[model samples]
Target: MTRKTLILIAAGGSALLMLGALGFQYIGQMPPCKLCYWQRYPHIAAIAIGLVALWLPGRLLPGAGALAALTTAGIGFYHTGVERKWWLGPESCSSQPITGLSTDDLLSQIMTAPVVRCDEPPFVLLGLSMASWNVVASMLLALIWLQALRKS
Candidate 1:
């Protein structure tokens, strides 16, 4: 495919994922946790990078887009591991505990705890949670970005 077509595809793919995330949150009633939100940032960045690449002659934008994809892929992997109980997630989200807390600290923790957590898998499909799907999809995006770079 041409570089322009590739950029458009990459941007459109990210847009679709963003819209899907919104649909999940608003229509499907699945509130995103902290890590889930983190995974989205790269996609948003990639969409912008793709747009810029469309107007530029250099390959830097596609490379940047690849980096964005990779960053989100890493987040997705971390989130998947957290959801699968393979590792601890963020202190605010995971149930790893805020150890050695005093009475006041415990009260603060209770009051400030997030309603949704990064470690909990709110939805799953074919034994894979949303995070896992994100990892797979984001990696695919990285491949697409690489192809765009090659073409450029």
Candidate 2:
């Protein structure tokens, strides 16, 4: 495929993923957790890089796109781990220490905490959570970006 075609596939994939996430949020009524939001920033960056790379002639932007994809994929993997209890997630969205807090302080913390928790998978398909799917999709997009880099 041409460089432009590869770039389109890579960047368009990110767009589609974002749309899916939004659909899950609005249509499906599934709210994203803190890690879910973290996974999105790199996809947004990839989309912008892809748009600019379409007009430029260099491997830099394509490489940047690949890096963005990889970054998101890594976050997705981390999120998956959090959901699976393989490792701890951020204290803000996951479990936090309550050892030193008084009853009132604990109540305040609980009240102020986010409604969504990162360690719980709100939706899963084929035994994989949305974060798992993002990792898979982002890795594929990264491959496409790498192919575009080769063409450049």
Candidate 3:
């Protein structure tokens, strides 16, 4: 396939994912956790890379896009691990028991706790969460980037 086609596929795929995320947030009443938000940055970067790749005549942008995809995919894997309780997430988002807190302190902790957490996925499909789907999609986008680089 042509470089232009590859760019469209990669960028369009990222755009679609972003839209889906937004839809889940607004329409489906699903709020993303800290890690979920973290996974989006690389896809945004990849979209920018795709736009730059369209005008540039080199492999750098595609390589960067591949890196971006891999970054998100890695984050997704980490998120999956957190969701599955394989590892601890961030301290701020992770809930810890108040061992020696007074009533006032316990109340404050409860008041300040986040409604959404990285350890629990709001939705799952076919035994795969959104993070897992992102891993799969991002890897596919990475493959498209590699193919674009090969064509170049």
Candidate 4:
């Protein structure tokens, strides 16, 4: 395939993923956790890189796109681990010890705690959570970006 085609596929994949995430948030009434938001930044960067790569004549932007995809994929893997209890997530969006806190402090903490916890998978499909899906998809997009780099 042409470099342009590969770029489009890579960038368009990120766009679709972002749209699905938004749909889950607004339409499905599922709020994103801290890690969920972290996974999105790289996709946004990849989309911008792809758009610029189309007009520019160099491998730099394509390489950046690949990096962006891989970054998001890594974040997705981390998020999956968090959801599976394999590792701890951020304290702000995950459970913490309630020990050694005054009653008022505990109550305040409870009130300020995030509604969406990173450790809990809001939705699962085919035994995999959304983070897992993001990892799969982002890796594929990264491959497309690499192909575009080669073509460039």
Please name the candidate that would achieve the greatest lDDT relative to the true structure.
2
Model 3 poorest 10 in a row by lDDT: 89-98
Whole-model Cα lDDT of every candidate shown, in order: 0.87, 0.94, 0.90, 0.93
- What tens digits encode model 3's per-residue C-alpha lDDT throughout 35-143? 8899999999999989989999898888899999999999999999999999988876534566989999899988986688888899999999999999999999999
Candidate 1: which stretches are off by over 4 Å? 94-114
Residue 47 displacement (Å), model 3: 0.6
Worst 10 residues of 2 by lDDT: 92-101
- Give the Cα-based TM-score of candidate 4 against the true structure: 0.87
Give per-residue CA lDDT, model 2, range 1-152, as digits (tens).
99999999999999999999999999988878889999999999999999999999999999999999999999999999999999999987745456988899999988987589899999999999999999999999999999999999
Model 4 misplaced regions, further than 4 Å: 94-114
Query: Would you estimate the TM-scores of all the predictions?
Result: 0.85, 0.87, 0.87, 0.87
> Would you give me the overall lDDT of model 3?
0.90
Q: List the residue pairs that clash in candidate 1.
A: none
lDDT, model 4: 0.93
